[model samples]
Target: MQTDIEVYVLSCPTENIITWLEASFTLVKKSTSGPLCSKLTLLWQGNEVEVTILEQAAGKRFTSIWFDSDKTPWEDDITCAKQVFKALDCEVRCNFQGWEEEGNQDPDLWWRINHHGEGPFIWN
Candidate 1:
């Protein structure tokens, strides 16, 4: 049920990704004032991939981590996800009192980590 890392996705736009892609991006999901977004099917490398913007903590929470990484959207979503989460974390760190591990520093951390749940990059 496993496969290679999904690339060419709408990644969360982590700072690292911003540095990598050298482009600025944003999440187009329900958490914001944008149009309600539904899970969309996209073609990457001629492969069909499933993509969704995961929402957490009720309406106050929102994130589009691009669930599948073995497809095109994976790269775009995760990269963007990383950046968006990082940005969100940077801002909420002071107001939110909790130890949320920022994205890993290792380039292959997401792929190398021993996943206990769903995938290789679940972190814990």
Candidate 2:
């Protein structure tokens, strides 16, 4: 079974995405030891969480994102993630299906953010 989680998928350039992520959490170490792309280890919930920055295909200019953290107070991470979206002025496709497994439908919904202005622009 998966832990109760919220995954935020974003589309943005490398530098801007890194900037937003750095602002959201304390940077523990940046590992250029990876072959594909540099990985970032960040501090969240008093623990280290890893995030991979993947470059999208040509003509797309979008980036893929992922993170790992403990269960307690995941909401704090959610709030921080949203702040990154807003800071980057980028759209986000988010799913909280883990909430569904726990019979908590509130976070199980899907939403999209379009940055026409300062907003999440989330819709069901």
Candidate 3:
């Protein structure tokens, strides 16, 4: 199973993201990495998970949440995306399937969860 998780949310405020992270995980440290990015270090299940929040990642619409560790709780990006959507009550997007270097995959295809529903769609 995949350990790391990366997802994207559309039109979400940075403060809301921090609030959700603080409520869900034990926040260890928070730092402003750049004008449009923030770095967060969190502890989950006794493992350190580094998260990077990047605004305007997709043409000024989507913000990327990158969990840079294999110790994330979820199995994959889609699972993490669902949890994030439920917590933030916003639109979340993730890759349709786990990455496979030698396997055929459509990079534009993504699984999206929003207020309306969840489904697969071409992102770009």
Alpha-carbon lDDT, every model: 0.32, 0.56, 0.91
Q: Which stretches of candidate 2 lie over 4 Å from their true place?
A: 1-11, 33-36, 57-59, 71-81, 96-110, 116-124
Best by lDDT: 3
| Residues 37-82 of candidate 2: C-alpha lDDT, one tens digit per residue | 5578888768777777656522254455656554323464345446
lDDT of 3 at 89: 91
Q: What is the lDDT of residue 71 in candidate 1?
A: 46
Between the candidate structures 2 and 3, which one is better when assessed by lDDT? 3
TM-score, predicted candidate 1 vs. hidden true structure = 0.31
Which structure among the candidates has the greatest TM-score? 3
Put down candidate 3 lDDT per residue, 1-124, tens digits, no spaces: 6756789899999899999999999999999978999999999999989999999988798999999988887889988998999899999999998777786999999999997999999988
Total backbone collisions for each predicted model: 25, 0, 0
Clashing pairs in model 3, backbone N/Cα/C closer than 3 A? none
Candidate 3 weakest ten by summed lDDT: 1-10
